[model samples]
Target: MTNQVQIWTVIAGLGIGTLFIRYSFLGLLGNRELPEWFLRHLRYVGVAILPGLIAPLILWPEATGGSPDASRILATIAAITIGVWKRSVVGTVVAGFGVLYAVQYFTG
Candidate 1:
């Protein structure tokens, strides 16, 4: 069992670490214009984040221990296709749900 002092110390340490990270970003780069190379990488942040989000869904459909569902796979495919073909946000969502519902009904 941990003592009160130890628990308070851990909480304090975490709070300090969070503040330091957020402040460092705002302090160092907030004032200056980012370099061209940095900007180029930042432009790809979406490419990185989007796939990171989608990949887990496709690869680990039932990561929480339930049986995997196929509708999600079909929806993702439609979203990617719509995103590629029309490059429209609405189109992507509509196509994705359209695929999901269609797959569900057809499969059911």
Candidate 2:
């Protein structure tokens, strides 16, 4: 795999990116206290990111190529089903992945 990119570089990049990303929030917050206005608005971060969280599922489902297949669709439906039926986030994710993998095995 001489022509292939170095695995270390890819890992290093992932590490740097992860560090920078996590640092952006934790580092800034840990350095000093943020203003109350910023704190007041912090609650909205979840609301603001809500669309960012769901947009890919509906619009760019194919972006990830494999994970977003029909199994994922069924898994998402399963997640919603768990949320409605059990109202548990942990249960939803677990059940969703299970549903996805099970259906993927059957289909593939």
Candidate 3:
């Protein structure tokens, strides 16, 4: 198959899979409250996944061609600190980018 065909097929499959996953929960749990244990665990999903997704980038950024850099690592640390302190996603992202750029500029 052509690359475009393969890409489209994957996209379609992912869309259908997402639809089923969403529908399964809504349909199965209609008008029912989720168990407290499950709900509590679900609350950590974002926290857990966000760090997992970000840690690799901070440790070995693609922009640095997989090399570990002080600027990115410090920026990530600052961003996490600001985020936890302020509880603001926008502030955290802005701080992270700002620090990353500043560090790159000054060091280079």
Q: Which candidate is the best by lDDT?
A: 3
lDDT of each: 0.86, 0.81, 0.92
TM-scores for all candidates?
A: 0.70, 0.52, 0.75
Displacement of residue 51 (Cα, Å) in model 3 is: 1.5
Better of 2 and 3 by lDDT: 3
lDDT tens digits by residue: candidate 2, 43-85: 8999799779875874457656635566667787888899889
- In the range 15-100, model 1's lDDT, one tens digit per residue, is 99999999899988799998999999899899889888878777677653554577887798889999999999999999998998
lDDT of 3 by residue, 1-108 (tens): 479989999999999999899989888787799899999999999988987898889887898899999999889888989999999999999999999999999999
Whole-structure CA lDDT of model 3: 0.92
lDDT of 3 at 5: 87
The lDDT ranking, best first, is: 3, 1, 2
Candidate 3 RMSD to the real structure: 2.9
Worst-scoring 10-residue span by lDDT in model 2:
58-67
Query: For candidate 2, what is the TM-score?
Result: 0.52
